[model samples]
Target: MIVPNREKQAKLRAFLAKEAHALGFAQLRVCRARDAQDREELLRHFINKGYHASMDWMEETLERRAHPSNLWADVQSIIMLGFNYGPDEDPRQLLARKDKANISVYARHRDYHDLIKGRLKQLSAKLLSRLRETHPEGAIKVFVDTAPVMEKPLAELAGLGWQGKHTNLVSREFGSWLFLGAIFTNLDLLPDEADKDRCGSCVACQEACPTGAFPQPYQIDANRCISYLTIENKGPIPHQLRSAMGNRIYGCDDCLAVCPWNKFAQQASEARLKARDDLKAPALADFLAMDDATFRQHFSGSPIKRIGRNRFLRNVLIAAGNSGLDSLSCDVMPHLDDSDPLVRGAAIWALGQISPDQDFAHLANQKQDQETDPDVKAEWHLALKGKTS
Candidate 1:
């Protein structure tokens, strides 16, 4: 039988860290594939409470997501990697600018899934090659955000960072802006000491939530989250939470931006992860006017493109309605007749917000007969009945 080699494993771990840094990872740590039952219990509790919203996939893949051993039984160690995508300025500063679309900092660049996955593969290959030289039976797997892996918990176990009250990993080195990836392998490696929670009496992340998404200090009600509402929910945004969304068209960053640990955060090291100039503060009117072709062209490599034009325009319409800029009425009016019922419904809601009651009544009457979609018809009825305020 092959014997365990502690010295060889230690050397390999150091080599892996060096390769990870060269591959653009900001931090790297390792942990055993076991010892994830507590996280699994937390996930089950969250799902049982219906906090996952419409994301049924979470329920479907619960077993595989709970622990790495269940995902790949032969896996002996999990390598957690972090890539910093921290912004140069405070993202919260744009919340007051109602005319500008507030896209989340992470979504402002090319998709991290693509950028980080490539690096993970390269690092995985390097580790696999090294392992094979010593043990021919060694095997490996790499995952970015695409998998159901509980990356946050695994990262914490690997001592990369602690999951703060906002539920995202908070790093002393990179704050709340690190992108996480994982490499699971059969090779035994030394695990790092898990990081302790540094969030003392501070509740800044909880109070900063525009929609009060956090039900408690560490619990998140995804259904009430702006990020889930704008990016995950495919239907009309809940009327109760629409006003709170303000001008945020994609994801909300209130909680992440308010973290106290961010004082140590640095701007993203990877140039590709940097925010594009046009996306920093795009006008709501310009975003609303983007048809499918234009939307794809502009956000070709962006995570925003995954939502498609209909869902994207739907979000833009909500931001326009909240903008309170009467001049944007010209931009919002055209979409009232948009082919997509979701877009048209959102446009009607936006119209009511910016237009006078008399003006909205006239427009509603004009569109009422032509609008056959039940959802769009409901929007017109709601606006005409003076129920939109």
Candidate 2:
């Protein structure tokens, strides 16, 4: 019969913490992946209210989400790590530019998923090296937001930080601007004491959301979230929320930007997390003209690359429609013949905004000959009738 090596496991934990700090992680903590009844209620409330919007995967695999053991029976410990990616400049500064594009700070850099995953895997490999030398039976697994794991709750249990009223983890040190990731193992390492909730009575994060995504304290309905509508939802945005969306083309940073705790936040050290000057308040007209190849090239080191050209242009057109930038109408005209119905629909809306024919008859007449996609055709007809397209 084999028994775990206690001395080596202790050394492994300390070494991991040291290596993790050197890797640019602001802080790290550990916890036993226990039952997360509190998180289950929050997720259930979000799902019931239809806040998750089209992110249906959040509803699937419910059992594993509520109970970490359901994901891996042998898992006994979870390592919660936080990486600071705070921008040197304030994000709210973008809000003042209601006429310009507002790309979230996180997307200003290379895709964080790629960056975090490679780093986490390296850390996991470090542990595996120690396991091979001593506890040969040890095993490791890594996860980020992509998994069904209840990372926030486990992170709370690990003393990384307490969950704030807005549902984002907040630390006294790095505040709410940190990205979270986790690793679970079969080792029974000592768990850190959970952080005391420091939110007090502040409701700034909730009040700051432009779309009213948070229904109550500590809960978000993803359906009403600008981030979800812009990044996750595939179809045309609902009319009621479009004007309120302003120029946010990718994701909204209002809630995260308003948190007072972030005053203590430090600028990110990862050169990959730095803000790209071109993406900072990028011209809506420039983003509107991006073809697939151009989109890939422009966002090569940026997270916006994942959304593809059509989805991105659709967002830009919506902002252009609300922009009241009538001069932009000429720039939007060519997209009426775009291959994607989504683009054509958005183009029609932008045309209706700037084309002063009372109705979009001028643009509709031009599109009638070549346009396909019944959705876009009907939209063109409505635009011609002086109706909201």
Best by lDDT: 1
For each candidate in the order shown, give its overall lDDT on alpha carbons.
0.89, 0.81
Candidate 2: misplaced stretches above 4 Å?
1-12, 35-42, 357-361, 365-372, 381-389
Give RMSD to native, each candidate.
1.5, 2.7
Model 1 CA lDDT for position 381: 88
Residue-level lDDT of model 1, residues 262-365, one tens digit each, is 99999997999999999999989888778889999999999999999999998899999998888999999889878889999999988888888778887778
**TM agreement with the true structure for every prediction:** 0.97, 0.92
In lDDT terms, how accurate is model 1? 0.89
Model 2: how far residue 271 lies from native, Å = 0.2
Clashes of 1: 0
Residue range 98-212, candidate 2, lDDT tens digits: 5678899999888888888788888888876866755677787888888998877788889989888888888888888889989888867767888878988998999999889
